[model samples]
Target: MTTSHETSLPTCELGPGGPIVSRLALGTMTFGVETDESVARRQLDEFVEAGGTFVDTADVYGDGASEEIIGRWAAARGGVDDLIVATKGRFAPPAGSHGASRRSIHRSVDRSLRRLGLDAIDVYFVHGWDDFTPIEETLDALTSLVRAGKIHHIAWSNVTGWQLQRIITTATLGDFVPPVAVQPQYNLIDRGIELEVLPCCLEAGLGIAPWSPLGGGWLTGKYDRGQRPTGNTRLGDDPERGVEAYDVRNTERTWRILDEVMSIADEHSRSPGHVAIAWLLSRPGVASVLLGARTAEQLNDNLAAADLVLSDAELGRLTSVSATHLPPYPYGMIEDFCDVDVWKRLGTASSA
Candidate 1:
């Protein structure tokens, strides 16, 4: 059933026929880590007050304290009956080799439900692809939970393009319920998902709820060229680790993207993070965007992106600058053909 609140945020179906969820979701990865329980509760209350219902958490975050904090908050705020609490499993907790076995799913869901103080979870995601276990086995386990009503929906996260397609196809042909959503690292700086993973999810009708919408805080305009971040921020405390994390995205190309984002933000009088998220929300096949905030104040600031709409030109500028230049064999060549005058009239893949 749809959690009825009638908030101003645009709503979308979680999947083909799943429950109603806000287009923007609150991510609690930092619940008990970067943010304490008191602040975590404040963030939760702020999110709900701002019309957000779909919350993304994981069993492994903060060594499971994230879910625990959310659990307490849900209980105190009139119970979890009206909230769509989404969490993930698959990463073993300290001692196991890996998870996602039938036994693991069974145990994980039970523990999650217990912690969340609910009889069932709104959505349960496999944290990552378990190479040790067969995809069929994982699907069977997830479907069993669905059959038992332990989880309302099953989701996938951090899976490759082929892995996502394989699982969806396997489920369809094997007569198991398909995944309702796929979570991946997506942002203006990380458009790698657009080449294959995105098209696959779109083709299969699965919802895309991208995490790290701010590009690991890179798009927030905090990092500087050749300068180490030094603060209580995500990268500031450990400059070495910050540089290592920054190594991947500290590029001339990324700087150009950041410049454009800042320009657009200035035009609209918004934060760079807000512009980045607003750009992400305007993408196609995106049912929801996960905003990971470190504090309630930051969460409230980012929430304004939900209402900030960019002009078509501004959206196209970001898209054009960040467009993926895929390999020439299939994607690039096919897109080239689509640009032909004749094929253009017939409609191209992107226009679909």
Candidate 2:
């Protein structure tokens, strides 16, 4: 049995030996947007009191208001010296420039430092891949930040397999500070990253901090089939909102996966979300799973998953049911004639 405030969750290194963070990281994307400061502060306090140490946020979240909220929280608590604070800076670039350009990155880092009330960011992530800027240019700017002590470790998010490989190649050749981690959206309903991105990260020895592990609330079992959400839910407010829109995710496959998750939850007497998150934690190369919530209660509910380890049979069932078919071109071709077991390499079913 666990105490009220003690999560008793394990820890993992972000990179091989980079900053050690709690297995479940608190994501502050809802700060100052869906949630006010007081609630946000409560969530942060709850997270830390429950043994969470990594807090992730981005400069564009709430148009920098999220960082400001976190900054105030840290100020009230004296400082986040014990926490591994991470923030991204590839969304809001300077005027007339791309987000990943040298000028934009330099400006973004300074602003993030000021907003977070920290001398140096613990883990600074480039929010996404920027085609407009060369990978070398971005790597150079990040290397300079490391030297100046403005940032400690570097990471990337929302990149493809080719892009990530290129970044690693460029940084290795140029002697730049390589990324310690890569953040991608990985969940049962969205296992697209397993195709190439996951393999690349595993090979490069980069930690994967996965976002949207609950498939934007689909894996939570809160939404029903054939019924449109109509409340204060993420889809209710705007069914056609972002990637997790109602219509987009309301498919047969989604319901099948959700049913399996609910079955596992019932067996464990836990929330469906607990099953979803537990499954992610069982995967390889998963350093931390980012948990985003709109309220303290939601965050607390998510924290319970730390203690819920799924059985091998249950995990295999979920993985099998949610497995996607691989494309026909290269992945399928290689598996067919080359005697190379792509399915074993992927650790999942070949079908996408």
Candidate 3:
């Protein structure tokens, strides 16, 4: 496997737009919530200097404060044309919204544009699928935006395989602009997407941009088995976000796997976070991994993953320890049919 560090950071075109972006995108979920304006500005400057053009934010992130911060940085930097900004809607304030209704979609994009200080968004995503609203209506609204120049491309986040497929089918039939990318929760510990969401993206020709690539800092080996992180840690400060990280089953397994990751990092003289991010970049269909950092030191360490390449032997060992079990039925059946040996020997040699 080729490490991102061994060569220049990869670039991919955003949908049909001409703007090119680095393979590693900076996520701004913690921009305003965990990090203040000064720290956020420093991180943004470092990222731009590192050749990272892709910036991901959401309308609901810190109630739009994240987008505002990013907008300020972009304006101050005076290179808005060179950046590929991607922000999501449908997760706006007042909390617990169902789906992307026409009114909500319009309002959300207008608010996002105001917060971003831009005339249009480079790429926009439906934060999550809405079961209550008709999928066609949502696609129609998004397509209208594309036609009106409000957004350049459409994308999806936190959607299931079936939902993604349905949206694609609707767009194709309606001649709407199909989604060009997907954002999902994917990492060593959260491999559920491998069974469905990933395959759907591959089949549809949509790029995969995974969020929480470090498993919300779990893969960095920061939290102990029984010790809870407090204060600044996302898990400690946010009760709602902490539940997933604090799961007993997941905590035990994450620590166990961290032992293996630590060994690999030690061999390469890198931090565990670097190794963890590298492992995600090694996976198939991973166009980029979204990483969030509160401090410049943390950001620098995470950025080094762009240069850290794991040898084939190291990748194999990490895979063995971190691979999760597939549930019975179609998934198990598919795994049995598409064995690893057959995959490497006869399957298509595409970058995962």
Candidate 4:
């Protein structure tokens, strides 16, 4: 019953079982935190039914509740072999035990395996860089885990371009397995990574999975310009932090841009969230957009992004409004003089 569209889309290989998955991956951050177990399971089922096999989660999410929920769903769904399970480690628990130390890494992986009920994780990510720890020590530990058959592949998240490059160089020197993917906070509102991280990822042949694809729901158009999100799950749980992240006062320009994006979505008969994610998928070197949905409806809407193609004019409009103004110097110089003709030849001008 697979449609031609689903059958023909390219996949990005993570490890052993298969090569490339459906371009969109379901982020499980809200699975066990904002949403209940039943709702999480239903969303998981719908994602699989839509031919989505890439599922992302992290140990620190909801204090391991995310992994537990995904584990239980995988057990019940009956197709564990076909799924690509990517989980991250290295985030300190609420109790404050966090690092890339060998001891901590091993303990984290073992605990994650128990929570996930999986023998080996498909792709295990270092949730964040540990400035206190040596990169070699961390990479070596990850390499050992891969050799031990506890992890199929290693990846990274919340790391800088320099950190990834150094790790790659160290791995090459040591003849260890390099990271295959990188999970970073990327969206229209937060294009900071575009300055350097994206370029490094593309050069390294590492697939990029963008988290906060909706800008922490800022791009969803649910929060009003003057009013606060009273009942929104993330906002309600942490008012102060939410106020800072979702404050419309500080985001007036972003909201103005969102208004235009909303108009485009309305014209296309699509949700703004779908259009937001669609824009990410249209970018270069974006292997997958990690969408965290609180409900099955939201997940279904996001899945539709894979099929939504934004026109050149639409992309141009969005880019003009959402472009991040980088600091001056080499970056600004490059921005000003970067050859548009070269990108046009490569067909990446629209995405730039």
TM-score of each: 0.92, 0.96, 0.89, 0.88
Ranking by lDDT: 2, 1, 3, 4
C-alpha displacement of 230 in model 4, angstroms? 1.6
Query: How big is the RMSD of model 4?
Result: 3.8
Which candidate do you rate higher for lDDT, 1 or 4? 1
Clashing pairs in 3: 5-307, 283-352, 284-352, 285-352
Q: Which tens-of-lDDT digit does each residue in 1-352 have in candidate 1?
A: 1344589667788777766788889999898888999999999988988888788898888988999999898878778665688999998533454587777877888888887777888888999988888988889988988998888899899989899999999999989878999988888888778767877877788888999899778888999987767777777765445323766667888989999999999998999999999988877678889988888888888888877989988987887777656566675577776653422221223432
TM-score of candidate 1 against the unseen true structure? 0.92
Show the lowest summed lDDT stretch of 10 residues, model 2.
1-10
**After superposition, candidate 2 runs with Cα above 4 Å error:** 1-7, 338-342, 345-347
lDDT for each residue of candidate 2 in 155-193, tens digit (9 for 90 to 100): 999999999999999999999999999999999999888
How well does candidate 3 match the true structure, expressed as C-alpha RMSD? Answer: 4.1
Model 4 lowest lDDT segment of ten? 342-351
Name model 1 segments beyond 4 Å from true: 1-5, 93-97, 239-244, 337-352
Q: What digit string (tens of lDDT, one per residue) describes model 3 on residues 12-104?
A: 654333345677888988889888889999988888778787889999888889999988887887748877899998866334545498878
Error of 2 at 3 (Å): 21
Residue range 1-352, candidate 4, lDDT tens digits? 1123453333555422223666888899887778899999998888888888788998988999999988888788664788788899887532444489777888899999999999999899999889777888888889999999999888899888898898878988988888888888888777778767877776777888888888877788877776767785565455456323555334667787789779889989998988898888877677778878889998888888778889988987787677765556565556468853423322223332
